[model samples]
Target: MHRILVVDDEEAIRKNIERLLSLEGYEVATAPNGQHGLVIARSMLPDIIITDINMPGMDGFAMLDAIRHHPELDRAIVIMLTAADERDSMRRGMRLGADDYLTKPFRREELLDAINSQLKKLARFNREKDNAVAKATALTEEKTREHFREQFAGSSFPASQFSGYTPDGSSGFGVSLPPESSSTQTLQATVMFADIRNFTTMAERLSAAELAALLGRYFELACRPVVAFGGTHLKMLGDGLLALFEEDAQPQEDALSHAQRALAASVGIQDAVGSFKQWVQEQYGQRGLPSFSVGIGLHSGEVTLSRLGGMDSPEVTALGDSVNIASRLQAAGKELGWLVVASIDTAQLAGECLRHGRQELVSLRGREKPVAACEVLGISAVPSLQQTHPPFKYDPASLQAAAVQNSEMTARAAKEALKESLWSLQSGSFQSMQQSFRGYQIIRKLGEGGMSDVYLAFSAAQKSEVVLKVLRTSLSNDAEMLRRFIQEYAVLANLTHHHVSRIYDQGFTDDYAYIAMEYLSGGTLKEEIRGRGTPGNSFTGSPAQVHGRVIDLLRQITSALNAIHKLGLVYRDLKPDNLMFRSEGGELVLVDFGIVKNVGEHTVGLMPERLVSTEHGQVIGTPYYVSPEQATGQEVTHRSDFYSLGVMLYEMLTGSRPYKGDSLNELLARHLHAEIPRLPPEHAIFQMLLDSLMAKQAIDRPADAMGIWRGLDILANKTGSLPKARID
Candidate 1:
């Protein structure tokens, strides 16, 4: 498979060498003499070279030297084939970089062995070349420290040149700098703070020496990504790192490059820490190295770069409102689950390549205002650079804006009604149920599932209405599930998206558990579909509009699903009944997370067990929507949701179940063996998506929920009108 080039003056010798090498399975090319061989070497860029030491019109020595000078051919293995046995000739060839010397009339085996050995040596060298590339990439941060010193030496900042250098001097920790004499002298710079989450626990678990060693290695890895983009590490706050960026000394380099580099640094640190955590887990059966996340905040403004303390221990630092706000923005990310939080200014300077991550708002401490921040997915600053960065796109504002607004009319009703009824018995026993029932008007039973009955209730405190779900007493014994349900309330509290139902409060009256949530005026999907059939659902106002509206609803659900999946979890139970259309906003909102599960690499075979308890060696989920693999107890993934969505889509369009069965056993068997229902003639794009989602093989499905969204986007734009409904 390797290419070899042979050169010699004698025609017989060249022919014989080519024939022998060809038999040895090398792709062989040859030149008549040393001069021609040099041309061949330059032209072919062969893996190995063989040439005579003494020859006419430029001997092998000249050819080898010329070949060595060609950058492309220099590393190729060269063997000197010669009639001259003189020590001087061998020395000259070897010095000219001939890899091996094979004298004339040598054994066929000797020639082949020499060729094989030299080829192997070349291979080994190539392997080291690859390893060296990886090592150099890993050393990017290490190299930046020296570069930082040089840049610092040239900068206008006088911190390093100041009089104070002693650790105990005025310039030390908790010290303040004097006010600037002139505002014009201050330079605008972007300050950034990147903190590794949960680092203290890692330190506590590790011995002091181990912790020091780990920190040294981690800092070395972390520091490179920062330096790669031209940011200097200002200081370390325990497990967190702070970096600042200003225009480089060279005016030719834009500040954008520095922002790009900072983004890259964050990515490098993530990769390094991830690999470290994986390594620790593999070697010690413990991922005790620390689970870390990064938050980056950048604000551009005037900042005084200075040095304080005594001459012997001066510390370099930057102090200003810009720097303080950037740090505060980084702190705000802790509450928002953001990895790389940056100010809008930073994002603008960072440019599109770095601006793909989602935006979030956080309420900072001691500040009346909330800061608008964005998370950076990867480094993609320059197009000319290798495009290895993964793309991340999330829009938090769009998601947040979609939530249903509290109508003034309903808001007034809720406040007035809650005060007289359930709000009074917060800490205690259910004294009078008849009084509670009479106090507020329960519009109707919104829904009743296995363990709870939902009712739309009006409150007097806010004078608004809310949905109240009262839990059944029979399920109170399942403490673990109850605890999970309580924990889910906290999770819901943190998520501010509109499609997700907001939990207002939770309480128990003696033997009953209840949760108050946002009231949606529309009925469940199941009720509307059953009452109105396919075209004229009771939920939808018209038949023609229903098809287009349902498609839009699916889009909303898919968007919410995208957000849910981004949190590193899967919503296992995505069924029609769980999706409710809020007629107030004309938006479909996801209501339940009772079956949601955190998914990761190790959760391959675990999801089906949680969703479907084994009843007589059978598992869970309505069999109609259960993926073929899940029916047989196979592992589920994000793709499993696609299958369920496909089933829901079919029902929405055709007013019938895709596959029906008399019992759980029959349903499970039919799901495993039956063909999916045929798509109706209407909505070709919808049919295409449904077919793809219901594909028998998981790999055949779209890679993720986003893929489905993208397809829908294209379809929506291509079709001028919304998809039409088909009715018999």
Candidate 2:
């Protein structure tokens, strides 16, 4: 057996890899970090070394560099395991003598294939290896491939499926005829076109060997679903798959129609992406590469299957508008952010399974009009073959819960079934409600809060993206809160400052109170900060740039506060989440006007509505960032927002909030009494800003938004070329 060494900072990932490799009959040894990994690599001289880049001590790169310097470990086939998005780390690893790269979330087959491919290279080039051992490796590799084919395809993947592709880049969409068969025929079929998004760009960056390995893995995963559903996978289209589920595609014993089978196959491919995403997250967590997703377009119509060339250089292909349209739909999916974009006909023709997504009129480039299609969310039904190819998608929590009630499958099957049953329960009511709620057509829910669920909706009259903030029906009985919501909207309706969120409309449905607002793509400052690091502070850039950037943001927040403060009302809940970015340009806007929301005066919660008031009716804001005045239930002013902004600034400059407490009362006490913390040495220039803004007595803070803005202006002028930042 070939020996392998697995190194990673994460215990779970290291053990998972060790288990996978051991089951493959490899002698696998594991290490928790780079220091241990290097020690083991020298002692054991493993045949293959698999190391992750990020670790607590040393790190994979340093360990690999050390191995290169040592003559004994130089011969080891080094496979660097990296987060999918860590291209720079991969390049560095390769320079340090890495033999191969395996992205996180890789399938067991992909891992085995990487090792086998490397072994095959050694067998061919290394003269000392015995011929018998070389032959054994090759044979074993072939057998492994065959087993994989059986595992995913549920049968053999015919070697001659797409012997040659035609020149037009269109074969009319079919499983081509035999090499000697020249007859052309037309028939009705359901066609599924799936292409990897951004594959061309990926191909450009990768070497021939890397590209070949990635494409092989993707095709294997992609083709399995088609072959499993009895659809003929047409592999002529590069980086894309074309499958046909025709009259004779399904087995006679199986009662599924071609459209249903095609739908099932599309769902399977989509599920593979979902599984791959989980794997990537498991391996790399938040530091992973961009998750790969396929845009699959399904349509059922008449297509022509054609054959080209003589028996010597024969090619089986398809030709028809149906094929062209199907391909177009697949490409359109990328722009629409839909995984499966299928025609209405395919959705209607599909059997009893719930069509669990919204309807859309998809526009195509060459066509004069739009094609009606459905955005596939997920299918409630499993494939007719009984289970998906990647049966690892079981929800373990749900399975354990079900296991308490009794059931066991092929060591894993029963758990997957239980998870599927749970999904089936939720998906029963998954279709669009199609209720005539004014002119807003609800696409899908964007988020849910304690009192409301927000949906991405479209206004037919406005012809733009809109968000429907639908409050729960229970809120209707709270007439005082409802009256406040309408009253707040009426006042906010006139505040047309660019930084204030535009409220398009407001109304009440039989089920909820709703407000329509413009959809901002840049998300919120909280997401922007959190994506970079913990709690918000972890920005990376130069010292001046970071300081200047913070100053610029403070200026913008003060500018928005200036607008709201003009109305003589304090923004009780001023924090990172309430500050929204209009776009990538990063202009900030204030959102979720806290005045509109009124949860019970006593309830302390995270929601914007939870602007709390003690039993004595002294009002307060959210904890952590709550101003001293708000925490103590004293009178709040524009200066109160200045205090909150100070907390926000402190959280940004440092990696933590300044105050901490075990409970709400404790937390409030800290906010009221805690001394303002000093900025890091490099950022000490801003200590003056924090000192005054976070004064225990509200009287010591800046008198108005203008006062805060002027302070920021002085800082900006002090630092030339302001508004640029990051930590190095």
**Model 1 Cα lDDT, one tens digit per residue, 1-728:** 46688888778777767755653445689888888887766656677888877678888888888878974566678888766457788888788887888877777668877876665454333333323322332233222333333433333332231111111111111111223332213566677776555443333334444444555555556655554555542343334456665645554423345556556666677777777765555543342233444556666556665543333222345666677677677655544445667777767767777745556554554455666667677765464222422222222232121111101211222223323222333333233223253234566676555345678887554468887776532212233345344435544655567777777765543234567778776756766667654455533454345556656766777877776666555666678778776773455678876656556432212122232122232233555678876677666678888888888888777677788864455666777777866876664557778888888878998888778877776666665436331110
Backbone clashes (count) for model 1: 40
Q: Candidate 1: list runs displaced more than 4 Å.
A: 1-158, 161-186, 200-209, 224-233, 248-261, 264-295, 304-321, 328-338, 351-517, 520-590, 593-728
Of candidate 1, the 10-residue stretch with the lowest lDDT total is: 398-407
Candidate lDDT scores, in order, read: 0.57, 0.63
Task: Output the lDDT of residue 84, model 2.
Answer: 83
Q: What residue runs in model 2 are displaced by over 4 Å at the alpha carbon?
A: 1-436, 474-476, 533-538, 596-619, 721-728
Residue 303: error of model 2 in Å?
65
- Give me the overall lDDT of model 2: 0.63
* lDDT, residue 92, model 2: 91
Per-residue lDDT, model 1, residue 251, is 42
